[model samples]
Target: MEAANLCAIIAHVDRVSIGKRLAEARDAAGMTQDSVARAVGLERTAIVLLEKGDRNLKVPELVQIAQVLGRPLSYFVETPVPAAVSRRSAPSLAHASTRVLDIEIDQFALDVRALVRLGLLSGAERDARARVPRSHRAAEDAATSFRRRLGLDSQSPVLNLGRVCETAGLYTFAAALGESGPDGACIEVADDSGTVGAAVINGDAGSGRRRMTLAHELGHWLFGDAYDHGASRDSERMISSFAVHFLAPRAGVQKVWSENSNSPIRDRALAVGVEFQLSWSATVGQLMNLALISHAQHDDLKLREPRAGDYLRLGLSWVEELEAPYLSPGFMAACLTGYTEEKLTEARVLGLLRGRLDASQLPQIEARSLEDLRQAFMGHGG
Candidate 1:
């Protein structure tokens, strides 16, 4: 039979037999339904229902479950096993499906895989209190706390958001297209694209725009928002605000501005760089919140066109002719490598790594590779 037909057969067999067949498959493999549920974030009861043919299943969910069971979806279709048995340690399934690239791209898929792996490995069990703040003030307050946790001084200079994301253990990528979907997205191996770590930014945009997009996506990841491949403008605004506060805390910006009232807002923008809109807006908002700037000045500034040119010029000087780190090769390499290493090892052991590596593209490495591998194995590595 053709591979596709075989896969369909497997899926059909699993469904018709009321999960008894599935339970036997699990038993033969020595895996519990609970384990599969945990891996996919489904309820244990749902697994029982699935096995018993009592619940209808979506194609995607069915595919995922079949993958976890180490058979093609068609396997379930062809031969339904009885539900009485259980299994242990079923083979790991690919995390996502494969699709033709909707857009042409550059860069290694392995690196992409690595980034997804790192993101999963570094995934935070978000605190309930980490909800998005309502007002700008609340947002700023949260930013301050977060910055403190990172041991950053409020006034410390920041440029190149990709670097910031890398530091925070996020996997990010720049894409040439600006599709109608999200500025970027996080996905597991199970998504059709089968990418592990990726955040697509508008590659056509200037460096400044790319930085903003990176920060925006990182904000979603950090804030623990459910992954939405298509985020709305309002969601972008909220995530943008979160990024602003995350990068430039209110108190520090206020203190710096207070020390130098004559410091041109233009200069502050320059000092930070082109991606400073959110930071600048947040700073001005904080001043207004503290009753420093009048309502009129705030309104005027908000209405003003952003001085992107001015900020770029000033920011360039501060960096002593070195391009922003986000634009640097080292930063990109570190981010891609760090994320890939973290994810592949973690997700593989966790049974989350899916898909096959294109061995032809795998890189030759040094003895340090072993050291790095050991570090990740111990969970002490990035």
Candidate 2:
């Protein structure tokens, strides 16, 4: 009985410690108990009790909390709590209200890193990260540098921005973050040598928004030191400007808008969209930022959405494709590598792909004969 009592006492103490850590993590994440509860699908009292060690805590629930709070699972489950949790005085809270969408992005970055570390995702071609300079005109500098390095003229459309970013050593993925969530988010991963090991972006936004989101997220990575845990309005605007210029250079706008469409602002913006694959409003805003369009002219153009057949009428050819792999690049590449190396079973690969893609979209990989490769690569050497 005494031994059982001592064991009970130790268990009770552990619970108390977990409760304290939970409370601290919640505060640091700048979330209220209610918000955390809502995210974890628990009632407010449940969160309170869990934090106080009065309620049972499950592993999955704790993990969900860690994700919602942007705290690592290790932070909660690992021994020897961090100093921030152990200190007598409460550490200063981060931004009191971060968009939950950003928190989801944070989790996405973590998951990608984990997958890459586990060899479930390919890390090939990851060393080409840009050495971006910091300055007031950082966005402009980045835009110019990317164009020059990639041999892209201002008018050249980024036919595949997702592949472009991935080739540039940024791990890009898209997820349906819901309408209320942010269109995108970026996180920077690095090593002790100050090398950017990996960068991640959530570009689940629609085609137009996805392009802009990729630029904005890349801007955050190139200009800022690291991911901004507490991004402010000004910082958002700055990166937004970078995105605008990166996707639609001043010269490109002038060349496209001047050649065909020159009248009302809406018409000019729509014309830019047709040429650039950008949202109409963003194209107009970029023109305004570059002083190509005056405020009066911008105001005069009625802001409206694209009607049906707008792309066909405008000669935008890329829109006809039913689906593009913006969100599945990393996973797809990893699955391919695994299958080719015989590291993963075909059933596993198909099952995983089915989650991210339609069953019909999944491909069957068969070993190609040397003759087939020679014919494919050497054109039969005729």
lDDT of 2 by residue, 226-265 (tens): 3333554466566677677777877888887787664655
Q: What is the TM-score of candidate 2?
A: 0.61
Please, what is the whole-model Cα lDDT of each candidate in the order they appear? 0.47, 0.58
Tell me the spans in candidate 2 whose CA falls farther than 4 Å from its real position.
Answer: 1-103, 119-138, 191-206, 227-234, 261-265, 302-306, 309-328, 339-354, 358-382
Model 2 residue 303 lDDT score: 53
- lDDT measured at residue 93 in model 1 versus the true structure, 0 to 100: 14
Q: Which candidate's lDDT is highest?
A: 2
> Considering summed lDDT, which 10 consecutive residues are worst modelled in model 1?
80-89
